[model samples]
Target: MGGSSLRRLNARLVTVGVLLVLAWGGIGYRLVVVQALEADVYADHGLDQRLQREILAADRGTIFDRDGRELAVTVDSVTFYANPSEIEDPTTVARLLAPLLHQNMLDVLDAISGEGTFAYVARQLERDDADRVIAARLPGIYYFTEPKRVYPMGELTGHVIGFVQADDNQGLEGLEYQYDDSLSGVPGELLVERDPHGRTIPQGEYQVVPAEPGSDLVLTIKTEIQFAAAEALQRAIDRTGAKGGSIVVVDPATGEILAMVNLPTFDPNDRSDADPAAFRNRAVTDVFEPGSTQKVITISAALEAGIADPDTIFEIPTTIERGETVFRDSTTHPSELTVTGIVAHSSNLGTITLGEMLGAKELHRNLYAFGLGQPSGVDFPGEASGLLRPSEEWCAVNCVASTSIGYGVSVTTLQMAMVYATVANDGVWVQPHLVKEIVDGKGTRVAVEPLQRRVIDAATALSMRLMLEEVVSGGTGGYAAVAGYRVGGKTGTTEKYLIDEQRYSEDDVVASFIGMGPIDEPRVVVAVVLDSPRQDDSGGKGAAPVFAEVALAALHQLGVPPDDR
Candidate 1:
């Protein structure tokens, strides 16, 4: 209506037009960014929401015995998993899977009940069962191919080969754990584009990066010898009413273990209810006082130091005292005995006298050189170094005397077997090992070259072998003699040390016998250890018989000629 008002309205309209132009410019800039400049990045981001990356499992290796028999192996297996949150009806799904999975419906229901995204309904299922689960097509239940470790020998080689985890197939114990890296090859990845409901989209982006398979292991275990040892040990347990036992057989010249078995073993196939204690390989992991079986080391030490020979004479007192401890021979013997006679009789005073000649430091050094006081450098996992304190610590009280008589020192069955193996191998100490070779997926071969060192001179070893022969022929180890073979060995029985109580058990004892057969060219060394036998409890009676059984079988299996003629 007024001239001033008309001018104001035109100015407002111009301002509005400028505002619209700026808004359009900003919109064009945004459109260019979304359509062209960052288009690839945005497209990738959107696709990422649908893309799923999955870990592809590698195939585990196989374990073979010396004879190429499959001791442990892996096969294709199926595992069914579920996302409880995604499950439409847990009860119905559980019901469908229970019978096929061989699991209780209630247990399955509980596993699939929670809001968690993942739960294992059943692991390591067979193809038939897995196929049945697939046919059910229960929502939220997912499955993919996974490996399952199996032991063909069952409890026969349980403690040695060990087992792996069911789902991830990770090594859990024994040689499997020892060489996990070599056995577990590189894993791969799989990319899959999925829809909103977690379905694989049709014609969606999919790619697979292949997994490299693991290496295979070949052990030194002779199946025949292993079976013989296992059977003998089991019979020994039954006859003696013993808690358990262990047997170790080795090739004296090569340091390769032939047979290693432990009782109280569990099946590695399915360890759902297996006691963890059954997993221990006692020959390598546990230790015990060696008793008279250790006399060889002392005698060999004396011979090595030129302090005594097999015929060297010592006057043995009936009872000898060091500090408050008084030591006596297990059985009555003459007042004086030559070194050979002393070993045969297992004279405590005689051994102590010889130990005084070598002293503690030299003895400890020799023992360490023999692979005691340290791990045997075995290829198996969880090997113990055994208990050998520093030599300087032994000068106090009757430590030296106790050690000489095999009361203070402790050793594993494998260690003791290796000790006798040294004497059998012309006084050379070699690192004992179970794995003979490992072949990888790349066709690379890994052969075992065991460590070797001379523990004693060849002459001393000859003398020690002769002295041990006398033990089996006329002494406490009479039961350890192998038929048609000139065998040599030592017997040991010691009070069981109770670690939990920090004391020795008055009643329980560890009975053991370690021996080698075909004495002139000793081929086999076997160590038998029985735990807490009530009847036939002494080493000579309980463990020696087992040693004979195993040694004979091993010798025969190796096609060794008998020297009885």
Candidate 2:
């Protein structure tokens, strides 16, 4: 009986020991699978949950005036971001950060209440202000350094230097938009480990690829000249009661835009209430009938064709009937005047007579040669190739008379300026450009070489220059005379064409004067256009004085000595 009891107890003990061994074996196998077989997969999953990738914005390139003055620059600014999913009680967090960020509490709440992991709280805060927000120690809120675009010259260079987007610093208008890619550099990458509360994990998976800076642009714009032109234009607008205006100063020899000013300008630094309409560089973008300022081209073309010399005489009637339109000069002239007198007095019939001799195709060819009816091919964006219809498209009845007298055509201020500039440059039309050179981060410099083409013979250009001198010295452009220099120019006054109504406004006119200085050795060419002048509506009274002021300032700035009287 004792042996049987012992055997049964031993069997029970053996059963319990076997079950314990099996359980231990299963536990050990499971541990091996988790720690060795699939260890890499589980480890990677845990790391991804803590890992963060960030973009390191590249430093935008600097914009410099011809004399190395900074126009546009990038400065250190703060951009605040948040981990919305990690934020506990978004309403409370928003209330704490709202006042510091200068944002409405509700707006802040909406920004932080998102279920997404990332959100922007505010952008582009000054460093001192950003530090104050950091001191608050709010959970889920984070900050990073972003570059802010600043125009130091303010509204003075705003039209030409242009402004950028607030958040990304992307170029939006003017030169900023024109050269965006060259200005925006390559961005870098950042990898870091962060805790769920938006705090960077110390000594955990930090990496960085430093960003490269963008190339810099050196412009041909002279600051002193730009300021003078702007001031003079503003005064013209005030005196003439004109809505707006544009002034362009160029170096005819090099086609360098010395100073380009457009009114209704704005401060690029603070664009809180800026009108988008004012963003256009009107000197390059807007077009108008050049009126008699185009006479320079017409007279130059006639001389180039050898159809009429400056001394050639023509029957200059006060009114000449052509088709239904009786073409007439704005001011009465002698019944018969020399070619020079016709140009000096700006006679419509006299120029039409020359146009008849030159013929339509020859006239069109000459106008095209003088840089009309085509884009000036300036480095500037949106340059209007003044509207010139093909000779075949010209209505046989009135196109010749109207076009010869600066009507039935359109031209940009810059385009017409270059016409006089062409004559000033010895009949050579050099491609216009604002930028002088581009400098890369490596210190390599590339100069912008403008294209040049001969529009007329040097002799013809010289003859036209002398004739234009008469216009300023004794004729219609007398008001454009500079105080100490021998200047030559033409007056232009055209009825303003209303785009919406598709007709010329009876009351408003575009008054313009384009001129060059030191006639024998031309240096500067200035073009002024005043729009919709309520008073002093003629180019002689409205736009010529602007030319005088800008030309004198430019000549003095260039150190061009006054011509011996």
Candidate 3:
């Protein structure tokens, strides 16, 4: 009986021992599958929870004038961010951040309570305000340094500097948009680990790829000259009760633009309340019939082709009849005038006669060589290649007559200025340019060379300067004479064509003056253009005065010795 009972108990014990051994073997097999076969997959999954990859912004470059004055620059700013998941008491956090960020408390609260893990509370905060926020040390709130584009001179160079979009910091207009690639820097990367509490792990795995800052731009603009031109243009607009105006001052020798200004310009820094119309850089963007200014080109062509000289005499009737069209001067002059006298008086009759002699092909070729009907290659955005019909298209007799008087053809103020600049540069046409050099973060500098070509002989250019001097000294552009200096210039007034009426408007005229100084050795070429001035104010009375004011100031600023003195 005892043996039977013992045997039953032993069998039960053996069954329990066998079951335990099987269970242990199954657990060991599972450990090998997880630890060895799937080790890499589990390791990556764990790292995903602890490691964070972030984009680091690179600082944008600075823009400076030729004199090293900062025009556009980058400054450090604070960007406020929040982790919505960790933001407890969103109402309290929003209330504290509202005054510091200049934001609505309700909006801030909504942002912090969003379903997303991260949200922007405020972007580009002022340093003082950011400091205050940092002192507050609100949970789930964080900040990082960001680069903000700032225009220190405000509207002084707004047209050329242009502005950027706040949302993505992308350039939208002007030089900013045209040179975006050089101005925008290469971004970097940041890799770091975090703990369970969402804090950076101390002495843990971290990596960084440093950002490469953008290259700096050096412009050919002279800030002082720019200011003077802007002031003079504004005064002219105010005096004439004109809609708007533009002025361009250039160094004839190198074709470096000293100043380019347009009235009704907007401040690049704060464009939220600016008018869209003010954003246009009229000097390069707007086109108008050059009026009497075109006569300079015609006279230049005639002089260069051996057809005439300063003393070449021609009978200038009061009115010229070409087919059915009648062309008359601003004033009646029935006497004979020399080539110099014709340009000085800005006679439409004489100019049209010269155009007939030159014919359309030769005239068009001369105009093209002078940079008309082409972009100035100014490194600016939205430059207009003014309206110019090919010689073949000038079959109509009216086309030749109208173009001779600057009626049918159109040109930008920059092109007109460059034309005079070529004459001042002894007939060598230098391409107008804005940028002077490019400098990288490592202090490497690369210079920009402007394009150049010969438009006329040096002797012809000298003769043109002498004839232009006659204009300022005694002719229609007398008001353009500067004190203590010998001035050379031409006055222009043209009626604007009405798009709706399909004819030229009698009241709407563009008044302009193109000039150079010290006829012996010209230093600067300036062009002033005003739109829709009072009918009583012709180019001689309106634009010439502005030209004198700006040209005088420019001469003084450039330290040019007065020729009169």
Candidate 4:
């Protein structure tokens, strides 16, 4: 009995030992898998009282103007945050911070007494203000370095250089949107170890990868020219009691936009109180009936096709009927007026007759050649291609006749400027551009150049120039005169159409002027648009004066020598 009992007890002891070892091995394997293969899944967070890791955000980039002037820049600031769960006395802390932040005490207390471990107390506070808040010793409140964008020139080029939003660092409009890719850089990261007090330990192990700030953009706009154009256009708008106004100045040689502005422009600094319309860049964005400014196309086409010469006589009377539509001159016309006279007088009857001789297809070719019915490709967002019904949609005689006289269609002021610029540039269609250069995050620059494409013959351009000269000297655009320069341009006072969501018909008016000057060797092309001008007869009176005033100012500012030739 003794031998059997001893053997059984020894065996039982060995089996128990083996079972314990197997259990220990199984637990060790499970722990290894959980910690190594699935560490991120299981250990994703830090507990309420334990120290944890946090991130330090990198600095954002800055923006500068063409002349290396600070248009927009980021300044170092602080963002205040609170650990609501750590605050001992929420009411006391709120009372101290509410006045410092100018926030409601109740709101502050609510933020501090919440169940969350962290919440924003204040963001983008200046250094001085942040220091004051830090000195107050408010419980559970802390701050870190932040970047805020500031505009040095206020609203000077606000329309061109758009504003950034609160959360998003990229541009929302204008050249900002146009060149956002080059301007926006990748954000950097920082791994910071925090203690129980929610403060970073200076000696703690930290992993920091410095941030690369965004690139800088240099635009073609001249600040002084921009300011001058804005002031002059604004003055005209005020004097005429117009609802709104727009002006664009372009280098006729290269098609570089020097100044483009729309009245009621906003200040990018404080955008909260600005009207939505103030953000719109009307020169390239807003479309309207071009009226007589479009007559240049007809004359150019006629001259190009040799359908009629300037001296060719047409017995243009008053009104002429085509199908159901009756086209008439602004004033009664004589029985006989030369082709040049019809252009000078802006005779609707005469224009329609000439346009008809060119035919619809030929007329459309001329308009398309002039850069109509497509995006101007300017460096700005939200630019419209404008409304141009295909020639296939033309309703026989009525549509063709109206199209001839600059009706039944819409175009942007930028497009109108291009027509004059093309003539001034001897018929070369250069793509309009705003950005002159792009500077990368590493301070490297890539320059831009003019994209030239010829659209008409040199002979046609010269002939058209002479006709436009007639417009400024003896025709509707006479008011846009420079005393010493060989000024030439056109006037357009189109009836603003009343429309529903589907259709439109004429009732109101949008007065505008398109011109180029020192015609002997043209340098600049400018166009001014006054929407719904009050107390003016036509574009000749409402818009021509504005164009002349701006052109004169621009010439004087640029020190462009007067043409004594």
Candidate 5:
């Protein structure tokens, strides 16, 4: 009986062992089928459920002035990102990143544990903060490089260099916006593979198409001249207690703008906190009612039309009758004034009488020919084409007479400078340029060419120059005279615009002066306009001094020998 029972027990043990071996073999076959036969399908499914792809931004271009000074540039910065799936301790990660990123712990936790596999913890982190984040080494938290634009010069050329947005590299104002496409280069791409632990595999096959940096832009502005002009105008505005001011200096021969400055300028580096009005490049944008400064154009037109001679004598009077309005002389001279004396003295009565000979139609035509009432085509944004009503819109003989003295029409400071430059350059109207050239990423240069046109005959320009020289030699713009330099210009003080279209307020007036140096062979033309100065200030007192200061600065820098020397 014992032998039979032992044999049965041995048989039962053998049966159990065989059944266990068969079951194990079947499970192994199923595993081989799932892992080896359908490997690619399972891998794709896993990637689709947890993997994501994003863009890595490219660096922007560098902006330099004519002197190779850095105006705008892109710098390397760190940005923090998170992967919620791999965070071991959400509270610990939040606390670690909060102080470094200057973000609340709750906000960091929300970003880390959000629905997406990837989320931004902080962008544009400072160097110190980036180092702290890297030191923390919190799971699922990391940083990569990005770009930001840096403006070195504060408000010196803020209007010229312009500004860009902080988040996206897009130009917001001025030349930056005008030349944005050339500055913001094409962005590149990067691909990464992450493991179950949310760590990027070091050796993962990454397809990185390196980005192309944007081409560098070289401006036509001379940095030194720009700084000087800006500083000078700022001083003038402060001293005169004027509302604002603008000045432009142009090379009369070549028409290249040497310096362009406007007061109340903003610091481009901190443009985010500056006033919006300070961003205006007023030299090219603001149009004002140019007073007696326009007599040069009228006299030139009259001479060009064979209407009057430089020696033509017009009997001077206290006032002149034109239909209903009476145009009077600012001075109390009661003697006869020659055409030269009329221009030299800036006699509104004498000049209007001379313009009366041209009539409204011819006067308006000449004004249009002088680049007023139209765009000067300077390479900047928001340029204004000053107002010059058509001859058909004139009310009476006085309307025509008023325009002859530079009252009815308006012009930008740049346009006025160009007008004087044209006269100085013998009537050839050259278009102004801000950007000189565009150098590609590979150092290939694409030059920006300028345009030139003829505004009047050379003979007419010469006659006008002589008359303007008299204006400064012994006339209204006497303060603008340079000791050794033969200077010629005109002074203009116009009543400020009445916003409510009511009676003129004695409080507001725009004082301006436009002049050129070394009248014999003019090198540069300067135009300065100061708005709403305090007290009873005229162009001779307020704007003429500024013109003289800036002109002397330009002369000193240009190394022109003074006439007195």
Candidate 6:
């Protein structure tokens, strides 16, 4: 009996020992698989929970006028953000931020209570307001310094300087859009470790790639002259009840634009509510029939081609008939006039007679050479290449006649100013430019060189200048006379063309005047164009006065002494 019982007990004990050993082996294998084979996977999972990477914004560049006046600048601003997961009470946080940010409480609450890990409470806050938020010491609330673009001159240079988008700080228009790459600096990055509560762990896993700043632009604009031109243009528009207007002042010798101003402008600092039309750099973007201003080109072409001289006689009837079209002067005039008289009076019929002598090919060539039917080469966005049909397109007699008197052609104010600048510069057409220099982040300065080419002979330019002088002295542009300066310019009054109707509006007209002063040695060329002035107003009475006011102010600002004084 003892032997059988002992044998059974020993067999059971052996079975239990074998089962225990197998279980221990399984446990050991499981430990090895988890600790050695999948160590990297678990470590990465932990890092994903504790580490955060953030982008740092780089500072934008500044824009300055020729006299070092700051037109556009970047300033330090703060952006408020919240960790929704870490926020203990979204309602309390929203209530605290509502008044400071000028946001509705409900909106703030929704943002803070969102499902996202992070949410922006406010962006680009003023320093004082951001400091107040920090002093409140609200948990889960933080702020980071960011760069903000601002225009100090407000609406003075709004069109030219343009503005940046509020959401991403990207350029939207004008020089800002054209030179965005140079103005936008390289962004930076930061890596940091955080705790479960979303607080940065001190001195833990920190790395930063520093940001690089952008280059500064120095413009050719003169601030005082720009102000004067803007004020004069605004006054003209208000006085005449015109829709809008533009003024451009250029240095003839250098072809550097001194001032470019357009009315109905907006403040770049706060442009979100501005009309889209106010954002356009109208002097370069908008075009109109140049009216009698085109006569300067015609007369210059005739004189240059040797087809006519200043005294070339023409029997200019008050009304000229060509097939189905009939052209008439602004007013009834005598039958005969010299080329000089024709240009000074801005006679449409007389200008057509000159065009007949030069023919379409010669006329088109001269207009093209004067920078007509082309972009003004300004460093601006959406610059227009004005409409000028090719010489071959001038098939009809009306086409030839209309082209001569600025009817079949359109030009930007900048182009017309450059045309007169060409004459003032003695027939050498220097391409106009706005930027004067670029200052890099490392403090390196680079000067911008302008493009130049010959368009008309110096002798022809002199004759043209003398003829234009007659215009301001006693002809159509009499109101453009600047006291103590020898003024020379032409007036243009043209019926506005309706694009949809494809016909000229009898009641609406564009009044413009282009002039250069101190004719003996011209220094500045000014162009003024008023859109759709009252019917009683014409180029001589409307735009010519504006031209005089701006030209005199510009000449004075440039320190050019009066020639007649």
TM per candidate comes to: 0.87, 0.89, 0.89, 0.83, 0.83, 0.88
What's model 6's overall lDDT? Answer: 0.89
Instruction: Give the alpha carbon lDDT tens digit for every residue of 460-515 in model 6.
Output: 99999999999988798899999889989999988899999999998899999999
The CA lDDT of each predicted structure is: 0.90, 0.89, 0.89, 0.81, 0.83, 0.89
**Candidate 5 lDDT by residue in tens digits, 1-565:** 6999999999998998888888888888888877998888898887654454647565677888777888887887788899888887889889878987878889998899887679999877667768978998888987887777778776887888788887787988887888888887777776667788867777764567777777888876777777777877878877889988898988888767878888888887666577898899988888888989998888888888888888988887777887777778876554787788888888898888878889999999888877899988887889999999999999875788889999878899998898899899999888877777898778898987777888789988888888888988878888888777888998898887775775556789999999998887888898989989884267887888778888888888777888777
The alpha-carbon deviation from the true structure for residue 169 of candidate 5, after best TM-score superposition, in angstroms, is 1.8
Model 1: runs farther than 4 Å from truth? 1-38, 46-54, 82-96, 113-118, 135-142, 190-209
Q: What TM-score, to 2 decimals, does candidate 4 have?
A: 0.83
TM-score of 2: 0.89
Q: Rank the candidates by TM-score, best first.
A: 3, 2, 6, 1, 5, 4
**Sliding window of 10 residues with minimal summed lDDT for model 2:** 313-322
Comparing 1 and 4 by lDDT, which wins? 1
* Each model's total of backbone clashes: 0, 0, 0, 1, 4, 0
lDDT of 1: 0.90
Segments of candidate 6 deviating more than 4 angstroms: 1-56, 81-97, 103-120, 137-142, 188-210
Candidate 6: Cα lDDT at 193: 92
What is the Cα-based TM-score of model 5? 0.83
Clashing pairs in 5: 484-562, 484-563, 484-564, 485-563
**Least accurate stretch of 10 residues (summed lDDT) in model 1?**
120-129
Per-residue CA lDDT of candidate 3, range 472-550, in tens? 8879999998999988999999888777798998788999999998778999999999989973368889899999999
